[model samples]
Target: MNDSQALGRISAVVSENDVVLFMKGTPQFPQCGFSAAIAKTLSQLGVPFTPVNVLDDHAVRQGIKDYSSWPTIPQLYVQGEFVGGCDIVHEMHQSGELAQLLRDKGLL
Candidate 1:
């Protein structure tokens, strides 16, 4: 698929799922440390998220970065808003902000 097509798919996934993670692999078995970290964070919070494995599709891997204007795997979205990548998520988790955000979004 072209960039636009890929973006469309990404967009659909984002909008359709209240919590969606565009990552390098499945949440249960992430390929990258960042992806693994984010997945673990969500799991710890008992948040249910739709995992979009970018490794399975080149278009999506590139398209996700373009779609969010954030160059990184393990991109997070809650209630259709771009949250952040691993480091940001880590900070939020440490600061207790991640749980708050998830609670505010009714996902936690």
Candidate 2:
């Protein structure tokens, strides 16, 4: 499918899932260190999430960068909204805001 169509699918995945993580690989085997780190952070927070493997889809891999304007993989979406990447997540975690955010979204 084209970029638009793939983005549409990704949008649906983000919208339908409460916590969606667009990462390099599956949650079990994140291809990038940043991806794995964020996965671990989310896990420690005890939040259930859906992981989208962008490595499997080139269109999506690029489309998401355009979509989020964040220029990175392993993007996080909570309650159908963009929540930034590893650095942001780590910052939030450090401030005790990540757990609060997850609790607010009822995902923890």
Q: Which candidate is the best by TM-score?
A: 1
TM-score of each: 0.97, 0.95
Q: What tens-digit string does per-residue lDDT give for candidate 2 at 3-108?
A: 9998898889988989989999888988999899888998887888899999998999999998888899889999889999999988999998998988887777
Clashing pairs in 2: none
Worst 10 residues of 2 by lDDT: 99-108
**Residue-by-residue lDDT tens digits, candidate 1, 16-76:** 9999999988988889999999999899899999999999999999999999899878899
Top-scoring candidate (lDDT): 1
* TM-score of candidate 2 against the unseen true structure: 0.95
Task: Give the C-alpha lDDT of model 1.
Answer: 0.92
For model 1 the TM-score comes to 0.97
Off by over 4 Å in 1: none
lDDT of each: 0.92, 0.90
